[model samples]
Target: MLPFQLAEIVNQGKLVSDEIIINLLSRRLEEGEEKGELGFILDGFPRTMRQAEILEGVTNIDLVINLKLREEALVARCLGRRMCSQCGENFNVASIDIEGENGGAPMYLPPLLPPPQCESKLITRADDTEEVVKNRLRVYHDLTEPVEGFYKARQKLLEFNIPGGISESWRKLLEALNIEDSDNMRSAAA
Candidate 1:
């Protein structure tokens, strides 16, 4: 399922059935496999043990990158995220400036300025509220965290709790995956 589809389900404070999630993922995987795709960076699949078991039947997964973050940080991060209504591009509150304080409150000015070539405004997803984010994290810890143990038992989990932001994390990920910065780095990663 697309992020928006999953977001809608999650925003309603409900979970999509594992079977449906697995089926959607399987279809996408099948298509990628047909095209000779060697590796995939699955964002949020196999959240449950059953889903992980089903995945074993599909393809050989070498590594599972688990990014461990504090609950408070996760809540803040989710609350900060905004997306372009037109193109679905993501922007974060940390990167954007918010004017006013106290009761006056929250006037956003994205550092990207005018978002060149795009006419539509960026908006927060309905589910990105603090309460919903906390609930989602609760669900993750209760159900999805077990998947970490599943991979750990198989010696396939590479867990990290890094303090640095995206660039540092991306560098670490490329190192873990053993991907090199060759002339075709962009195409190879794609």
Candidate 2:
């Protein structure tokens, strides 16, 4: 698996430790810069303030979008996630329960939402379990809060609160980012 191979490389270790990925990324940027493309979007990378500084030195981040949802809300939303076994659709248990999933405590178990598309194959990730998700969130808060602050101090951050529902939340998110049309997003994703 890709993760397994990454583990081998990580375990083998090198003189460069935490910044190894950044070094590789800078190499990638150099390659992309040679092309006519505008630039690259680095998501889930540069997690630390140091990494942010390193990135700032290389290029300007036009917008740093932050989803400002309460931790309890996030925990509920994340802990209640259920996905189709064959297809990769995320259904929020805190809001709309899927039709099939039976995970989490009785108080927390969310109803499964059937696959959005008729394509039948859906699966939940192993790490989506409650304990794993809770720990993941704790780590996320610890790591990402600083990254958020890093941008906040530079006034490069744009935050959008999660609205009352998914539909509204997504609409607000796009509005915060100034995305005027969904067609462009769908086409880009496609």
Candidate 3:
């Protein structure tokens, strides 16, 4: 577990030290291996060049999917995020509708409105403020962006632009991965 101090720093939108993350990751990977798991998907790891190098030494990564979103949309979405204090469920109040320019694809993400019961209980996350979200984006550009080039050079990077809301994006993502949409598969997974 991360020390409380370091965890606090992370909650402030700062990147933690590579050594700490690497050690934690190594332990998890070992556990996964011991469980006879064939593969794993890491959502947000290898955020820095050092972490990427270390991960390369430990495993064979087949592909990296980079989901691209407009900065404005990203900021708005982050800031609009809320959690229900009573039930601990997450929701988004941001209704983003951005028109594309210069032949770019338009983006639209409707708000994930909460039920009536949880409406009054919604609370903004401390880190979802504009300042913190912007800081996180800056940190990503400085520290994590390089990892994209590292994977690109290895022909393992797939840059995917998020077209719209969750359903549309999910369909596009499935298509990108050449995964056919099947009711049985979705129900079984659920």
- Best model number under lDDT: 3
Model 3 error, position 65 (Å) = 0.5
Choose the strongest candidate by TM-score: 3
List model 2 lDDT by residue over 1-190, tens digit each: 3666665543343112446767788888888888867967787666667778788887778778776655565666766666765555666545532232265221223344664572355455455556766666676677778999888888988876654565666676778776776686788899
Error of 3 at 47 (Å): 1.1
Model 2 reaches what TM-score against the true structure?
A: 0.65
* Each prediction's whole-model lDDT (CA): 0.73, 0.64, 0.90
Across 54-163, the per-residue lDDT of candidate 1 in tens digits comes to 88987788888887755555666678777878887877665433444465433332333336554357788888777887887888788877899999999999887643
Between candidates 2 and 3, the TM-score winner: 3
Candidate 2 clash figure, as a count: 15
TM per candidate:
0.74, 0.65, 0.91
Model 1 lowest lDDT segment of ten: 105-114
Off by over 4 Å in 1: 1-8, 95-120, 183-190
**lDDT value for candidate 1?**
0.73
For model 1, what is the error of residue 123's alpha carbon versus the real structure, in angstroms, after optimal superposition? Answer: 1.1
For model 3, the superposed segments whose C-alpha errors exceed 4 Å read: 1-3, 184-190
Clashing pairs in 1: none
